[model samples]
Target: MTPTLQAFVLVSGALFSIGLLAALSRRHAIFILIGIELMLAAANLNFIAFWHFAPQPHQPTGVMFAIFSIAISAAEAAIGLAMVIAVYRHYHTTNVDQLDQLKG
Candidate 1:
């Protein structure tokens, strides 16, 4: 891999790791969602970087997949945020720790 591509991969990996940590450590639903989005963005960045450095014929496919993934991520965020909002309305709190009623 080229130096630029290697750097991009490293940066994306770091971002993904940080996002994972944030998601895992947070109890607030919205913060967790933000962390998930950050992770998705890191993955998207890696996809785009790989697409840019790929062999010519395979580049377009990577880009296409990246585009599709972006669309899917957007839909996921919308649905997730909607659910969060609904949950907040029902429970009046965004903390996951407060959501114990479902256990019963």
Candidate 2:
């Protein structure tokens, strides 16, 4: 692979790993949601990068998937935030550690 492709893959890998780490380390519901968003963005970046470098006529497929993924991520964030608000209203906290009622 070319240096540019190598660099893009490396960056995407780093971003994915960091996002995963952030998601695993956070306890606050909002932070966890943000981490998930970051992961989705990293995946989208990887898709775009691959499409740009891949030597195939189907390169646009990756871009289309990235667009769909972005839309889905936006919807997920909206729904997740609404759920968080509802949970906070009932529990008075956004920390996941305090949500022990669902532990079955």
Candidate 3:
């Protein structure tokens, strides 16, 4: 049987919670980036779920938004990763706390 709206919402909530926890608790820049990506995925999941349940799914607005979000997320990931790499090269560590010690 197909999953219900509540099920999708619950899963999305779980994903968001996990992402939030990871993002807040992690000390590595890469881990934080991963957590942010997870959070974005959760948002995308919600968009898809709502779109599937909408009365006018044929309108495609929700789908378009989701696609745009995915594109944005990809760009975000690229920029975040590049920053992480630059920080790592300069600091010789990926730890978030150590990043503050970077000097010009």
Candidate 4:
């Protein structure tokens, strides 16, 4: 059975909220990256859900957008993880609180 748009939206919002909280409350940089991924997943879900439920199902706009978003997310994850690895190598810890070198 196809899900309603309202249900999809609620789920997406909840996922985004959880992602935001995870991104903000975590001290580890990796956790923040995971949270960002979650947020991106939620957005992807919304795009697909809307496309599936759209009045004009013939249009593939949503699918195209979702695919594009996925590509961008993949690129983001790759670059972000690389940065995290570099930071870990230099700082020796993923904790955000301890890497405060910019403080004057």
The 10 consecutive residues of candidate 3 with the worst lDDT sum are 95-104
Rank order (by TM-score, best first) = 3, 4, 2, 1
In terms of lDDT, the best-performing candidate is 4
Give per-model TM-scores. 0.88, 0.89, 0.92, 0.91
lDDT of each: 0.88, 0.89, 0.90, 0.92
Q: Model 3 lDDT vs. the true structure? A: 0.90
Which pairs clash (backbone N, Cα, C closer than 3 Å) in model 2? none
Off by over 4 Å in 4: none
On TM-score, the candidate that comes out on top is 3
Candidate 1 Cα misplacement greater than 4 A, ranges = 57-59
Candidate 3 C-alpha lDDT tens digits along 74-102 = 99999999998988787789999876753
Error of 2 at 27 (Å): 1.0
Model 3: CA > 4 A from native: none
lDDT of 4 by residue, 1-104 (tens): 87679998999999999999999999999899999999999999999998888786478998999999999999999999999999888888889999989642
lDDT of 2 by residue, 35-77 (tens): 8888899899889988998886664888999999999999999
